[model samples]
Target chain A: MTDTVMTEKSELPVHMRRAEFDPVPELAELRDGPAIARIHTVVGSQAWLVTRYADVREVLGDQQRFSHARFLERRPPGMADLSDEEIAQARAGNLLAQDPPDHTRLRRFLIPEFTVRRMKRLEPRIREVVDENLDAMEKEGPPADLVANFALPVPSLVICELLGVPYVDRAEFQARSNRMLDLSVPPKERTRIARESRAYMAKLVAKAQAEPGEDILGMLVREHGDDLTTDELIGIASLLLIAGHETTANMLGLGTLALLKHPDQLALVRDHPEAVEPAVEELLRWLSIVHSGIPRVTTTEVEIAGQKIGPGELVVLALPAANRDPALLPDPERLDVTRGEMGHMAFGHGIHHCLGAPLARMEMRIAFPALLQRFPTLRAAGTEPGFRSFNVIYGLTSLEVAW
Target chain B: MVSDEQLLRVRADRDVCIGAGMCVLTAGAVFDQDDDGVVAVLDETPEDIDAVRRAVANCPSGALSISTGTPAGA
Candidate 1:
């Protein structure tokens, strides 16, 4: 197969470029062809975009050819003066930033903590968290911004309990994570937030080291302290904290909006509690809260979809497009909760697939039903609740609803 | 939900399971989970064969499988 490199320096839109609920039309058009297409990065660089469902599995599965570390090494365009120490500090501990051996090792320690059985213990607590927030939403009455009162707090409180972060510190951590992920923020400001967030996590790491509670961070400190570093602990905690809340919170907000827009579907979820699990699955696939996947770099000459992508070229997978690929299922665009499981990439795939998937799934299954059941007459309060397209995680910033 | 007419048998590879809960979610009557989230086959012959088959296919870890009691080369 011949290489389809985009050597031209013309202005191409970023792969993640999208509207409120869908990928831009151009991405679907790209799926028409084979192998690859050109897409711009957030930092004004070009990379090969893989849109098909099968090809995505190939790339994410073959970590030997596609290196996560090389992808992390690509700095934003403006960061010309970052010291090597600062660079290492920033990348340390985040599982998405590491490749095999390191990625394998870190994930092994985390697997047990996220197993379905382990999450079951937290299910009752998750129910309590969902009910507590619903209580507040009830006290606040109709016309509440679901994003603030219901969507955000459920995951925030759950993750805080899991990682041993103080619930009181959520406002601070959420602010830092939001700024850290927002592309519109100046790169320098984002970097500053990254540093501050790490510093804050470092203090928590220190405390965990001293007291060693039963939380995830403390478990690492007690069991794997010799095996892991302070920086690694901080990195793992920071990644889990940001990821644990942001992805689910957005799914809750966006999924609620999607269901409200289609009240027939919402009724299925509200009336039949058994329907809630599959509804959550369909929502994760349809909404696809994570718009663009974490980019991967080709470590060696690799052929994907019949295109010979050379070593070191960046490969961006359009996850929203791939999940909606017609080959995966019939009538890919339709949202049917009865459609058991679509095997979507919403929680991603391969060795680096979201470690917290079971936890995320449980949280959504519990939260969505409880929220819908509590406010049976819930409807959109305003015409325009905004979307978080600019942030790394796609979600509604605020969703106003009235009961 | 298991019946005498059905010949399907379900088995789980616990070590290979990542506990995505896809199996339990897909075939709730036939499959449940342990405290560690590894799948436990409560019933081998589920009344809903299609849901059980889909659960096997959708296991990201490929931990679940099915077998039928038939001669190999019949």
Candidate 2:
């Protein structure tokens, strides 16, 4: 056991690395055999990184063997001082932090609202949201940070409307959301910001409890108030608020930059409206905005790609490698918008697959084409867009673009 | 009349559906969403069986399924 620990320790680099916009070069080497690597995280923890596509699916698909709730066994290392009450409050209703029965229960309630049929009803409203952002960007003229002016606001407003959070509260929540997902932010600060965000949602939840609106929060209050507690409401609202925007916003920013880099592909998406849907898929697969997914812990000793992972061990899914795996797609690294039937794990896989995927996809399908059509000569400004490397969710902080 | 095994019947598991909507995107004729966005089966024997199969495969939540036991005359 001592020798095994030493070997694992030696395998890790001094500072564990994160993937960039593209799949890391070393990942290709790691994918072929012994697909697991010992890696460090921003939180200063070591995890077994599952690099190969098949292995990632195997690990993520089997929640019983690789438990999402195992990480909740203790407060984060620095957060050990947090009281049990505080910890319980933190975990309250965040679905990603849960396993089976609990996760399934909460998810079942929200599923109806997220169904493709439901999102289709939302498309017209989502389209309006996209167009309004585009109009503002057009008026703002060239040299605007796409991330700020366009990418962020579209989803931000859509989610705000969905949750019945007053649109005026966007800046406050956006700030808290940013800090909450930022790994570079000190853990204490992240925790504090998280608390603030939840408190803000709690206020909205209280209001919804008193008088339910035609929004998701309102619907939950009207329908499932008996089943759900206030903490759970806040947790659900907070997760949706943060997740609904941060991911799709990044995809918009990074996706635009990626398209600009590949004009041939961009032309197809711009000129052919039908191409938008598939382009979104290719972009989602290529960019994979979410970095290593929510880490899972092994409930039992398991072997993946001939490498053995012991019980209670943490496993990280390298999504970019999996999406670009030759086993999943031919010429896996190339950005082919026309590529049909690309079954990538960008939204993840299994029971925890992104609930807002349809909404995110619809937003993109509307936003990208509208942006291109509005600015016929849209191109990147001289300023290089800043990539958020240290953040838990990968995306561009600001992308300067001009027409 | 098609054999029972050959009959294609599609159903949406409303409880488990997270509404990724890949089904409607793949086979719109066979699926539609209700007012709240829960999937409502539009047609059990869709005009395009291949597209229906593709939709079933792509549904992220496994909310969609096909059964062959139900006969047209039953």
Candidate 3:
């Protein structure tokens, strides 16, 4: 066993070194003993890693004690890497970073557009989008990166359609959106991307306002009218466009990777298209793509699982860890498509749960089955690629599949 | 002939559902948008089990839930 060093809190690494999604080794180690332990972040912040199932659920479910707004207020140390203007932009666009009334208000504006009812109408269109990408994949032939060909565009097209974003400018939008997710990059670059994306979204929304369409951005303008300022509209649009595509894209590629790795489960899905509903849930649970829950701050001094959390401390809820905890899931590690686990925190819990979940699920259910059906002999081409380093969103760099 | 199996009603708390449009995309027969874009349950007791399951799975907010209560065959 490697020797455990009790070092100063300042010396801890802020970011995880191992690929964020590959937590098997960590799970094995934690399962062997204590579920919770102290881990140092590269930012020199001390965070308690809650690995047990019960603790994570308890922490996430209790909103009063654990506040999201307070956590966003306290910048994780080493954020000095960012410039003042960039920091200001982050603060301005901190809708998801807020709690309660503010969060409720912002979330209210977004919730209506993302409903299951609304998405159902778009099903055929989403299928068309999937088919379009698959058609490209087929044309491009084997050794093509699924990430580039299939995974990325499925959601990108969907979001573009939803928000009335011009498909012509998607390349620029994707580049800027990706830069926004890069935490390791200097703050200036991050801020620039954030600003550029917001500006582009604002332009899209403005265009929608001038000439409204049946899309979500048009609807938002029509509904809220004067209530939404230009910046807020841009902010909300940017959030939806980015959230709409990036996370779901990661899931599509990663979920496909997971299924490819487990041929037995893949065979089950292939054999039983009827099982797609439960299979998606099981895949979400097994992968837990979004590695950590949205960070919440301690509103008042509170104790969680016997640990004393001081007031105003930032707590990062580990969703993947929670979903995999043995206490909640019987085997925890195994991937059973039919496993009737209550539900997983892949989309998160409580009021702050993912707004784009329905669309993401729809994309997965449609894409996975269609792909399997279209290419019965689909298999990975060459050695599996590695995952991206530091970005909160977890996905393989590329998945080359061939029949 | 309606089987003895209880019919499942899927309802969405309008307060929770963000118009991700996913539910409709996944199972259109069960859910649809009103004139105002809020999700409304069209067929609380969907005849198809697969459609019902899709509606339940597609709900992003977890607002849509399935309930089993027998209604007198009308």
- DockQ each: 0.29, 0.48, 0.25
Better of 2 and 3 by lDDT: 2
Candidate with best TM-score: 2
| CA lDDT scores, all candidates in order | 0.81, 0.80, 0.71
Between 1 and 2, whose DockQ is larger?
A: 2
| Tens-digit lDDT string for candidate 3 (A214-246) | 887787788876776666677777777888878
- Scoring only the A-chain of each prediction against the true A-chain gives TM-scores of 0.95, 0.94, 0.90
For model 3, the docking class works out as: acceptable
- Which predicted model would earn the best lDDT? 1
Higher TM-score: candidate 2 or 3?
2
> iRMSD (Å) of candidate 1?
2.9
- Which candidate's DockQ is highest? 2
Spell out the clash pairs found in candidate 1. Answer: A117-B35, A117-B37
Instruction: Give one digit per residue, the lDDT tens place, for model 2 in A1-403.
Output: 1111122322322112344467557666676545667776556577787877778877777888988888875678666566788778778788988997899888877877887667778989988888888888888878688999999999999988987889897888898888888776777777778677777888999999999999999999999999999989988998899999899999999999888989989889899988988899999998877767788999999887777778988888888778878898788888888874536788987778888888898899999988888887899997777977767678888888988
* Candidate 1 CAPRI level: acceptable
* Candidate 1 residue A237 C-alpha distance from true site, Å: 0.2
Of candidate 1 chain A, the 10-residue stretch with the lowest lDDT total is A2-11
